[model samples]
Target: MPNDHYEAEQSVISGPKGKVRADSIQFFKFDGKSEVDPQKLAKDLEQLRAAVRQVPDVDPDERDRAVAALLAAQDAATEGDEVKVRANLKRVGKWVLNVAESIGVGVAIAVLRQVVASG
Candidate 1:
């Protein structure tokens, strides 16, 4: 693992010892700048927000929750907070994955993934 070139857009901890309890882990940040294009991510997040709004099966409350997640994702992207953006996007995706194809949500999320991948 080369710290200088490591782009950990996602991470997972597994195995028997991976059971992380609250206050059991210590985290630290490396002073590395992100290569992701914040503007591109923000644009796709906006599209995702629109797509979420058009989900016919989602009730008003659910739609609102999804949109809130998108907005948080957008904000995080603008600030180059990749982890937060992905977490928020996951929240939105979980809220509407079943109806993804019914609207443009699937496409929107895919585009966002591309933006992050190439950023």
Candidate 2:
């Protein structure tokens, strides 16, 4: 019989001291204040979605991903999860920053910059 992986748990490391390497890292800080207005961000994202659709340079797949990221960020903002909001917005910025000007989402670009510039 083949042994199942993780049938028993082992090798647990609990502390701030370790090699600490990963392909990605998620940092969530709760500073006790909402950084963005969820309602306004939702409206901006809708505008952004319309703009992205009209952009000839953005492919279907990229458009889909960016839209999804923006929606996720909006949801995170509404839920008061700053880390998820910023992370998702960072994904949107990475996907569309180069074409943001062309897409005419200037306000959006600026907003995203404030959130993701530090990222």
Candidate 3:
């Protein structure tokens, strides 16, 4: 396994008169392409699915949709099609972020954002 780290910084201005400002900085760890293993990827995706399912205050329908997206991503990975795998993963990441944000799971949302953006 290859351990690679990346950092991202973001700033936002909102609210009336644009007086409110928010900033966020995050560090993400990426799995190296050369080190990718299908079995490991499947396991990791399952873990992420479980985490999403465990989030509190999440709509059941939303959670089911997110899990379905993850399963599709896993199927894509099993086929060893890099393009399809990336596409499905991107879909899964987006759904994950949506669910996370709905339930106020800030950490998961930030992590998913980094994963989706980095890819």
Tens-digit lDDT string for candidate 1 (23-81): 33322121244334566658766766777788778678879988998899789877867
- Clash count list over all predictions: 0, 0, 0
The number of residue pairs in model 2 that clash at the backbone is: 0
lDDT of 3 by residue, 1-119 (tens): 14544443323343334464325443332334444565555666666777788867767887777788777766765665545555565666465766556665443345457557655
Which candidate leads in lDDT?
Answer: 2
**Cα lDDT of model 3 overall?**
0.58
Local lDDT at 44 for model 3: 60
**Better candidate number, 2 or 3, judged by TM-score:** 2
Give the alpha-carbon lDDT of every model: 0.59, 0.61, 0.58
Off by over 4 Å in 3: 1-33, 93-115
Candidate 2 TM-score, C-alpha based: 0.54
Candidate 3 residue pairs in clash (backbone atoms < 3 Å):
none
Report the lDDT of model 1 for residue 5: 45
In terms of lDDT, the poorest run of 10 residues in model 1 is 22-31
Give the per-residue lDDT digits (tens) of candidate 2, residues 22-55. 4544233334443445555556666776676666
Between prediction 1 and prediction 3, the one with superior TM-score is: 1
Candidate 2 Cα outliers beyond 4 Å, as residue runs: 1-35, 94-107
